[model samples]
Target: MTADTPAPEGVRLQKALANAGVASRRVVEQYIVEGRIRVNGTTVTELGTRIDPENDLIDVDGTAVQLDVSKRYVMLNKPTGVVSTMRDENGRPDLRRFTKDWDERLYNVGRLDAETSGLLILTNDGDLAHVLAHPSFGVTKVYIARVSGTVTAQTIATLTRGIELEDGPIAADKARLLDASRGESLVELTLHSGRNRIVRRMMAAVGHPVTELVRRQFGPLHLGTLPAGKARELTKIERGALLTLARQDSQASPGPEEHSMQENE
Candidate 1:
């Protein structure tokens, strides 16, 4: 085995928890402080304790802890007006709304605004989440926006060139007007920056200004045919592609739900 791969036997409780990709060191410490861990039928409360995972009996919250080989990934077609959070004191936009019947405990990889809608991915893989949502991961976001005022050829250039805002300069890696009316246009924007309300703020910084913003893609995953308020498991290919994307540097790409129209669109 490579030196980086720890031997399967004689690993410690904290190390096992971390190795199983369960919790961080600080969080596992809290479990220890709460006396929530057990070894060979005895409560383990010491923070410095160690035990072998392969041979020793380990339990957390009275449930045996086993290393997991499979990971769970979920893609939700988030509708506008629902908050994108695990929980809130105001009792709104809790993830339970969409995951009511799912067996897995899923958490959003990142977040979308309550006023925005489109692809929102959830997963039980903390390491994958770190790779997707972490800014340093540089995961790309693809958005479709409806904006006021005509998007002149020059305006599209400003988007490509970058615009300065109170939060600092923001620009799309690439963008184009997909549909246009007299004074409004649907624009597809792709970028590696996942800043808050970035699509809206970016358009406002320029002259067009967004009236409605919807996410169509995040990395290699798409909202696909999933209806709003409903969810589905990631296809084998979807799961494989995400791991593939994580291995490479970032790039602009589309996944799904380019706009928040009825499914017919």
Candidate 2:
């Protein structure tokens, strides 16, 4: 019960970190000695320090490390014409068809309209999902859009400057014209907004309606050569990148209680 006494429960800090894939046990021990690891906000340099992996927050070099081994992160290349929901009330093509292999109930972090197709993350980790899905976290998404008109440099400038929509004003973090020919344009846009049908709307507002839209990247995850309608577990590096992104955002923002108090005032 003394402040100096070690807790009686939980696994050793280095062991937990190693099991979480932070590094090998020996490397984690070195990290501890270097004061690069922290448990529950306190720097933990002792190799024997115990921590409740389920409850304690662990961070390495200021980025959080997810310790829950049961957590699952999956990436899916959703094809066009399939609804984002696992179950659709309208009897339309749904995501369930692509998720049968996962025993754990995984839900999408965000959505792409039925008409659009691209990278989608389905995960059983609620904490990671919340951090990635929430617009306040400012996770950037990349989209490749084919629009029905010639896209000039001026239009790309306008997208980054700002655009007024029905809900409010929005702006792309980055925009570039990939190709413009034969009365059609291929435009790549980077945005942090999670608004519904935002890419399509932005294209229309710019006088070039989107003929086809596909998400190319979400946060640190990219839709590489993964074929459409296929799903796969996130690689070790991919998972680490995602956790780091979530941790960085969560640390930069105020906690819920503090944000709520500010809102009330």
Taken over the whole model, the C-alpha lDDT of each candidate is: 0.73, 0.85
User: What would the per-residue lDDT of candidate 1 be over residues 165-224, giving only the tens digit for each residue?
Assistant: 775776789999898898899999997775667788788777677788778888887776
- How far residue 38's Cα lies from its native spot in candidate 1, in Å, is 37
Alpha-carbon RMSD of each model:
13.7, 5.2
Looking at model 1, residue 45 earns an lDDT score of 86
Error (Å) of candidate 1 at residue 218 is: 0.8
- Which candidate number would show the highest lDDT if scored against the true structure? 2
The candidate that wins on TM-score is 2
lDDT of 2 by residue, 107-192 (tens): 98888888898999999888778888877777889999999989999999999999999868889999999998999999999988
Worst 10 residues of 1 by lDDT: 256-265
* C-alpha TM-score for every candidate: 0.67, 0.88
